[model samples]
Target: MNQINNLVRHTRLLEIVGDLIRVRALGVAFGDLAMIENIDGDQSLAKVVNLDRDIVSLQVFAGGKGLSTDAKVIFLGRALDVVYSDNILGRIFRGSGEAIDGGPELPTDPRIPVGGPTVNPVMRVMPSRMIETKVPMIDLFNCLVESQKIPIFSVAGEPFNQLLARIGFQANADVVVFGGMGLIFDDYHFFRTAFENHGVFHRTVMFVNQASDPLVERMLVPDMALAVAEKMAVEGKKRVLVLLTDMTAYADAMKELGVAQELIPAVRGYMGDLYTQLASRYEKACDFKGAGSVTILSVTTMPGDDVTHPVPDNTGYITEGQFYLHNGFIDPFGSLSRLKQHVVGKATREDHSQIMNAMIRFYSGAVEAQKKQAMAFELSPFDEKLLKFGRLFKERFMDIDVSLPVIEALDLCWLTLSECFDPKELLMKQNLIDKYFPKSAHSEAEEGETVAQVA
Candidate 1:
């Protein structure tokens, strides 16, 4: 493409493989948008995916089923972009950035190119603030720090979508951008209804690519959502939380495209660039020094519960940490937040760190005691206490439905411990114990007095 003749058109395609079409053209850069016009003059969008010295391979947004060798390919001389504005809020879009919610169109909204470079380190603020989700397991243990990029690692048959929706509505963010890839109709409907029913739709923007949609569009959903989120954070100075579901589907789309383009495969037939592709999006989560932040929380489901699967395996290396959802609970042992230290004690109450450590310690003990009991070993007095504390731990905090503020959850943690063990046996910090231990745990006199006061 040149300034003198930027509109370049080719009337012949060298090859058409699946959704990919190859054309010989000059001055076309990678990722530049194009239009493929059929003999009937019907046009579909294409993107310059691979450019090997003028043999440009474009992935047709609509599949190549009805296209012919004589179809005209016009280079658009620009990258793929999406519409952005205040009007985009409360609206839903397909992966191609077209409105699918049957709402009014905003043709006048400014468009921003998607899949851009990550924020420069010099422009980023060190993450220090916490985004409270009100879920006891998350708030009390693995705290979600602003600008953090993390994923929920689960498998099929898990309620990861439910957990994601709960966090979307409950999280402390000024704006929400949700992107769903290869979702079935029910999953898409559930998320939409969840946001509407919880009264967050007014501040939310959704980009969905259903299972029946084009595979190329699935790859576009995250980029579009992240672009809108970046706009909201940098321009509007709004704290944005981006929720992406089933990134495995996104990776699968990439794999399918790579296969169509005849690219060499890496692990499990996934393209070798899987890690790079994922990092480019995850690294978009950032906090601007003088502005707001973009925090990403995504779902990556493993096939057959295999952690070594290419998708989750590569994700573990790029993301800060992961929340492992299993058996309908965020597993205390598997879930971790690497950035939680930035806010666990500083942003939260002083006793938060102590409470979190002590609770996990006792829970680990409980697991051991349960195993010993299962083996028919004689239970020690302390084992009995561990068993009881473990039961209360799961009931009070482990359930996905358990919602409580951070402070209240900490208080409940203390109460649960007091009911199971003597105050001296807690082995927590002396200062925290003195300040937070239930008065009834120290003496029956205080308990009776408390009951009398309540009466």
Candidate 2:
């Protein structure tokens, strides 16, 4: 043991202590740098087990690949402090918030603590305003309300990243905070270029932890993102939207750390407190009683497309509703936003609620009709009409490329309905049809004649 100025550094050989390999006499300072050193070989890493009064525990980043009994341990004097400020916008940082884009170092401002206390419940306001993404399915159908906590439930190989990028570019939010966990380098570059190309980088802040980064660092992303979002929202910036991709990676990091700490596994080798951990991040989305709000949209990928996967299963309980991403598009039948009703008719046009419901009901009939046709059943006249309606509905509304405001999209719905069957077959209220339906019945008649000519 050597004492210099009041700090001591003691080196001890590695030994097993209570299911953990202990490197005795490691120098420790109060919540300072918590890092591990390799012992025998230069390439191996060790895992930190615990930290006490003057002792620091470290877990190796490389899985003890080249470590042996004799190694060196060094402790820096401080806990991890993620740098944040307005300067962070347009800058790309690693999962640990270190600038990685070959840019200048971030100027620190009072070093805000990551994963700080939640916003007070009494300070929260009920969410009301709509957050339009300009995606027809999200905007015209399931409207995303401000301060809502929603997740996109998908599987691997799906285009969730693309969907997220589109929303980041198109959302009407004042600012976007994006956190990506365990992303591949290609996907990382995809988001970077997507934001830059769309010219939204000025208002976007990204925290990325690549698959090659330290798994321990993956745990820091959500906190980093939420901390920045809270700061922006508190400053009266309305509509701060946070997008987190691959929350499943974040959970896996937790499980790995739990296993390293020798904690007994709960479900599927994950910690029993998994739900609490996720809830803490999700609950950060709230409308301040007087200030702006943070709305959260995260992607939770299920393994083998299993909805019962612990990550998605727990997420479903915590979030308000979910958007199911399937086949490179948002599935109309599977995707839903529970708060849509709050804005569908009230915040949107008078005809929105009726047209939305009627269109979906007709679309469902069309799906059933298609199945009957596949079975070679005799087609009823209504069935044929439903099939035609379904085709038009998908082309006009279900396609992701369709972009329109809520009222315009609703009017288009009425036009599509009129193009199909008569107004009475729609079963919509007569007053709505009289007010919003197309005035020229002859238009549909002309379209029928045109189709007849082609047939």
Candidate 3:
């Protein structure tokens, strides 16, 4: 408030609207943290979300069920802040930044406000570097470049969480900030256990809002996680990989809160500002011109697998690209990384782009051959080869369980290609083939000689 503390306390008139409290306090700034003291001497967290002429609308993090008009509202004179430090790694936090892992509080750690400004574009470098997750679906097909904002689009019954956990352990980034919104306790445990077993938790900070947590907290989970990530990337100069799962839940929380606030519904009953709200978070992905970067990989589940649903639809507009996870695999036909060109060939091995394109192309052909076979048509020799290659390709690389370095994955591509057809039939660059083709795909005489030498 602009006035002295006594004047601020004198005008403490307010009214509660569900979870939102309108306090008629003058000169109150947005994002100012506050507390509502109830008659029972219990205080709950609140933050300034809207500022009218002189009335400030505050969203209570803990619902306002027990609050009253006469409750003493105390403004903390600052934005919502989260405790930050290297000590935060391997820790679990609630949406309000309180520890929930039976561990001691981290109040002594340095504090950083949530939802800070993103890195200036002029100060940001082009995301030319890649972060290898060792998952062919990502590393080979849609390379995860530094600071790229992307989402995994999937339907229910898909293994997006498993895929995310795999990436968390496999990515070579210096730090991992995992924000799990509306996750079941089991999923939360799975992420924690996966990171622990893989030895990545020591470099990870997890902020979770379980399905049972307050709806308001669920909305803040992403901001809190990104806040910590920004700290590590800017001050610590670390490559931070932020993994947010099931952002559909995040949007749903917003819808529920908007309904609570009596806001008009827009497209498909979602709040009208859905796109802007999402971009504010996704836009936080940044690659500092000289410092480290923050790359975002999130999951947004589609109801009934409908791409046109409000959440994923708006996300498509904000993020750089998306990984469409469906039918237990990352869909090569649907998945794309717009920034892959900056790294696939330039940063990876010279054959990375060629192998990626070739593999997906063959996979498409294999699908056609399968359709023809299903029609009871006699398969040609080429069709038969396609059938054989398709099975091996899926088994060796496409399956989510199949994890390998970019080099090994590329080598496997050549093996599957050779097993399907002669080198001339591949239609890849002649120079690339001659330079990078595997010896296993060589002539029969050369292969036998190699086998004999091995024997």
- Which number leads on TM-score? 1
Q: Which candidate number would show the highest lDDT if scored against the true structure? A: 1
RMSD of 1: 3.7
TM-scores, all candidates, are 0.95, 0.87, 0.93
lDDT of each: 0.93, 0.79, 0.87
Please identify model 1 stretches exceeding 4 Å from their true place: 1-8, 445-455
Ranking under TM-score, best-scoring first? 1, 3, 2
Error of 3 at 116 (Å): 2.7
For residues 1-455, could you state the per-residue lDDT of candidate 2 as single tens digits? 14222444335645533223455553453334434444542542333446665444565544444454555555545555677677878887776667888878766555666776788999988777898887878887688999999999999998899889888888989999999999999999999999999999999989999998877668878988898899889874657999998899999988987786678999899999999999999999999877899999999999999999899999999999999988777878888888888777777777777777888899999999999999999999999899999899888776666677766777778788877877768888889877877879646655767899999
User: Order of all candidates by lDDT, from best down to worst?
Assistant: 1, 3, 2
Off by over 4 Å in 2: 1-10, 13-32, 35-56, 60-78, 442-455
- lDDT by residue for model 1 over 228-279, one digit each (tens)? 9998999999999999998999999999998888899999999999999999
Better of 2 and 3 by TM-score: 3
TM-score of 3: 0.93
Q: All candidates: CA RMSD in angstroms?
A: 3.7, 4.7, 3.8
Off by over 4 Å in 3: 1-15, 445-455
